[model samples]
Target chain A: MTLFPRAVNETTSRELRKTFRSPSEIFYPLIFFVLVLTMFPFSIPPVPGLFNSIASGILWTAALLAISLSLETLFKADYSSGALEVIHLSGANLVLVAIGKSLGHWIISGLPIALLAFPIGWALDLNFLTLWVLVITLMLGSATMSLTGSSISALTVGLRGGGFLLVMLSLPFFVPLLIFGSSAATNASLGIVPEAELYFLGGMFVLSLTVAPWATAHAIKIRLG
Target chain B: MSKPILEVTNISLSRAQKLVVRDLSFSVSGGEILRLSGSNGSGKTTILRALAGLILPDNGKVARLEEKLGNITTSSNSVIYIAHRHGLEENLSPLENLNFLSQVCTPPPIRDGVSVLETLGLKTSMHVPTARLSAGQKQRISLARLLMFDAPLWLLDEPFTALDTSSKKQLESMIDAHLDRKGAVVLATHQRFNCKSHVLKHSLPMIP
Candidate 1:
């Protein structure tokens, strides 16, 4: 068999197993996403119109924060345990490893957040079409965030206080995704087609999908050096 | 004599802007072992990492030679490196960890994880999480990779640390057998290797 699929498959499976075994990795960011989304209604004045209009913004912001939270430990565990070194020296394709990790991260964190956003968006007074739009936008946006965040996490893998550095480095890149994502939901809520914003989020997703893994692999090599 | 499996020519490696190994050179051939001995902070691990291609030498060449159709070609895939850390996942059992490794390692594992773990005397605890295993047991699991992969050149750092006498002896024999199979090893350690093979010692000087 060719090396590409096998390497990516094993790495991704290993990542999934590790994350599942440690329940906290799967639950913490999810709980944090719930908490952040729940806080919006209580903190703001109780106006149905205000909450409805801004629900998408609140959801997207919470997702961005939750993804960053999950990414803090992305490469730290592998680097500290020396698994990263073994993977690198084992002649496995580092780019494929990066891609596998991003896929695993999205499955555990991004996918859950996207699904949870649906019910949460409904509770926030979002219409059915708007709620659908929110979930779809989050699915696209959080994946893009995970991809971009993986590179940032890999870059700061071994640094002291890397979590803060990760958030700072990734926030600027996440802004465009957040904007496009929330805009799509808001437009849907307002009865507009929302096609333009959805297309922008899709474009960003494709861009990050192509570039992030390579950048993450390079970052890993640099961090190791 | 067989062609050298690995060659290092005038390599200098530095860490954090400080030169750790300066103008060092060495080579290892089949059925041979290169032992790197040095005090702490003397750059033995750095040199091993450089040989493993994990770290690029600031100034020289480290090459792995493969005989292809009677011609030698430089190939980096023939080496396996074990670092100071055991690289075990705390949550995974030894069997699970090794099973994952067997699939990911290049050329794949010649021997399965269960037999290797059994040989390491971890038959009873193979299913226990690695965090529950003692340091010596974890070290044995790390060294299990030596048996798992068929790479010709092994770069091991402190492979003896945390091992009990019997386990240490077990590792020595494993190394000896690998050499007997025409494989090469470059090891960094403090304990004297109790194997019958002739070990060429390269002592690294402590850099000021």
Candidate 2:
């Protein structure tokens, strides 16, 4: 109804439309995530115990890479088309638009990985409790990854070899999420509650959700300047 | 003239690690059209960007008159900027692109989207993706953005490129009509245009 909400909705709808229009953009990374998960059992022993021991690590690492893979398209089209400049000039709050785009990205790239973690974890012989912890942790970690990755992607949108730059810039931020996430699942397997790790991951998610959009807005401004 | 709608005072800008616009200054009053003419790499686009607040000046400031309160404002909300790039999503149809622009526009769109595209002579291809359109059509689609919003100042960079004679004249008339409504425009282009409004040609000195 109002400008801010309408602008955010418009941005989100455009992103969703773009993502679905070319479904490959959404499927490739997810397939990569699944393939990476599937490869772990063959490389290591095929034993159920061995598979369960390393399942969380494989999922987190693959999800991280998959999410990173999708980040390249986050702002590439808009920036190249000069739509970002037009939006900026139109007086739309860049922060809200950034958040909306990030949300669309999470839905396409992050949410699927998180939802698949359960079934994939089962295929890797993870128990019910560990599977639940894996799913919860992946959901939080993936959302946080998308948020932080959006910022890094925005910062690198104007640069050459930006994909490499995005990974380099985002890895440090991803480290904490990976640590807390994998540990939460591992702890759950070991009969520990993993509450503290989940809390830490949630805190990181909230913190990133707060800061990444603003940082993304600032990054885009600098790029345009 | 009632307080220049937009003012650039002693502003300087750099591109590719070199100063492009050096202490350049100009102002655009209501019902006036300021054309930025210069040779290649003369920073015409840079000056328009500075006026739009997309680029911060290395020195001095750009100010704009707020029509309601009669006070000078430097915020970006007062200006409408059309970059050299078409700014339309290649995957979207012309109508969809205008709808995209309408969401964030200041005064917002009261007119139907189809009529606006028709007025821009894009009625036939209104539903076709912009990527399939010709260069002139894309430029016309970008020009259609001007009608989606109502801002006191317009910063257009190289607006006439790829346009045929008739479309060029049509756009020139649109700019003239905008000027007649007491809106100001700072346009950067080499194409010569004749309009009834006060036309001032400011040339940028080439980088030494």
Candidate 3:
């Protein structure tokens, strides 16, 4: 196997193990995702026509917030316990490490939210076809969000009150993904094919995968320096 | 005399835009221990970080000679660095941590994880979460990396801070054995390292 994939796999497995060691950490983002989505129904009217119109926007926004909240933890623990120094000295590809961590973050936080989106959309009166589109779009968009947020998390890992900075830095980047994802879901609800929005979401996902790891690696190096 | 395996020439480093290490230079060959002695905040740890390739010196060169390949491994895979904080996860056992370390390490160490924990007197704490371990115990767990990596050079920062008397003796012996095996060490510490073996020791005194 090539070194990049091998290193990425090793880092991913370690990250997964560390994440699961605390059950609360593993479930916290998903819980936050559900809670934020639940609150939308109360704040907005539960009338079928009104709820369906706003549901896609509400779901994307909630996923964005939950994923961002979870990212506060991406590098903080490693930085605090000095594990990151060991990793730096290990001579492994830091880019691979960054990509692997983002992968793990997506698996734990993004994947579950995407899976749960179908049922949540059903409760919001979205039809089966639209619900399916919601799941796919969420999966793509959340993965992109995780990748983008990973870079910001890496940059702010050790700073005092970095959590606030994380939101400030990443929230603007999220605007594009939100626009594309919610548009896809809304078009699906309107019985349109939604292909263009889905294509845009996939393009963003691909762009994030290509760029986020390198950006995150540079961020980590700057923080360590 | 054996060729110097590691050399640092006239390196200067800074933190927070203020210079900490100014015009520093040192080298060590196989079977030698370079002890960086100084009071707190004297840039001992920063210098070690520079040596371990964690950060680059603002001015100067750090070169590590590769004995087998004749290629320099300047900032990668040739040095093992133990920083002030133990890197082991608080929720994971020593065994798990070592296993994870082995996975990430390039050209992994030959020592078995079980034997290394046992040798470091971590036999009882092998399966216990590191957070439950005492400070000295955690330090010992960090020191266990000496047995877990194949790197020829070690950069240790205040490795004896939390160790008790016996653990300190044990660590010294471990360092002695490492030197005996032709591995070099650069240790930054305020405590005296007791080694009965006839090994070359160079003390680099730092100005506070």
Candidate 4:
């Protein structure tokens, strides 16, 4: 909290912008989400009551998984191009750098994802609380996913076929987020209070915000060294 | 006219599990150009990486100028590290490469990509994807770093590789200008620099 350290996230934000703008990167996850949901509707026979009952859980699960996959790009590109070293050498604080980039990730991947997911909910006929809860849960939950996933991504950068490796490394950390994300929506579906799940999710999000950046920032330094 | 700019009391390096360099000691005053020559796997790149503070040395300390020397201690502007990889994104053009490099590095005298390429004899291919450029051209793009960075120390590993005679001459002159400005260097190259004045040579054995 010292004023000596200027909080400019310029380098981190610029790198994040580059990843989000890559031609090969954009649109795949959103398309994948739509395609995956399309499968559930086809596999199960058309029963509107059945679909409505399970809609919140199903939609939130899809959102969580899709955003997890997208967070893999956070540090891999920076590592490969030697830009990560440059960032460290820039003498900016490692924690602020990590936070700035993670916030940008939530903006690009998580927010648009929530916006897209709501319309998909209307298609699946989700109720009002389920809609807002899903959006809120996903926004908070995906930030945790992205921050912790950055540590996993940095560790596996040079490994062959690292995408699968990253998921395997990070899935254990993400289990709580997934459980709360689905149950919050599912509990809301039953017209019951989901405040416990929401509060737990909120606590996990704060813990991630507090510690995940330092872990990830040091992880990059160790990987580079 | 006082203390030397660099002090390496005794430095040793180990990569992975094996000791590649050990118990070595040397120092350079300002404006000195020191060349390191040896066969492949002689640990030239490892030493260069260590000097740039990329890889930590196992046992020694490296101190730059003292506080009285007006050195910006935390800033990396005092030294620049260059190697074959160019450390550039291939998908981006040379112009974009300059922009990205400038964004990450600290404040310095920035140069246009076209002029950098021109000085390295890469004028016609400045806008091409670096992957499309030849090996020599890519090396030139990497060395274009010299144009933008005004560091006092250049830790160059194999800086002369894949360069034509004229390109090599250009680099030699560039290093000359660097030394004339009181900048020092630790250059590792297989090819001959052939500069007689103000050059120090250190040869290492290629460990079996």
lDDT of 4 at B121: 76
CAPRI level of candidate 1: medium
Model 3's A-chain: what TM-score?
A: 0.95
Pairs of colliding residues, candidate 2: none
lDDT of 2 by residue, B1-208 (tens): 4799987788778987899988888877898888888998998888877777767777887777753312222233567778899888887788887787677555566566788888988889998978899999899888876776667788888889999999999988888888889999888887777788768889889988
**DockQ values, each candidate:** 0.54, 0.56, 0.55, 0.32
lDDT of 1 by residue, B101-204 (tens): 77766666778999999999999999998889999999999888787777899988999999999998888888889999998999998887787789998988
Say which candidate scores most in lDDT. Answer: 1
lDDT of 1: 0.85
DockQ measured for candidate 3: 0.55
Per-residue lDDT tens digits of candidate 2, residues A162-214? 88888888888799898989999888888888999999999999999899999
- Please state every model's RMSD to the true fold in angstroms: 3.1, 3.0, 3.0, 4.2
Question: What are the clashing pairs of model 4?
Answer: none
Residue-level lDDT of model 4, residues B1-208, one tens digit each, is 7576666667888888778888767777777988888878778888887777767788877766552222223345667777645666565667666655555445644675667777777777767766687777777777877877677778888888888888888888988888878778888988878553478888877665
Candidate 3: tens digits of C-alpha lDDT, residues A57-150: 8998999999888888889998999888767766556788888899888999999999999888898789877899889988999899889999
- For B1-208, candidate 3 gives per-residue lDDT tens digits of 8778788888888887878878888789888888887666778888887776667888788877653322223233578888899987787888988887676666666786899999988898899978899999999988877777777898888999989999999989888888888988888777777875553444444544
**Poorest 10 consecutive residues by lDDT, candidate 2 chain B:** B67-76
Better by lDDT, candidate 4 or 3? 3
TM per model?
Answer: 0.94, 0.92, 0.91, 0.84
Better of 1 and 4 by TM-score: 1
Cα displacement (angstroms), candidate 1, residue B165, comes to 1.5
The iRMS of the candidates, in order, is 2.5, 2.3, 2.1, 3.6
Per-model clash counts, in order, read: 0, 0, 0, 0
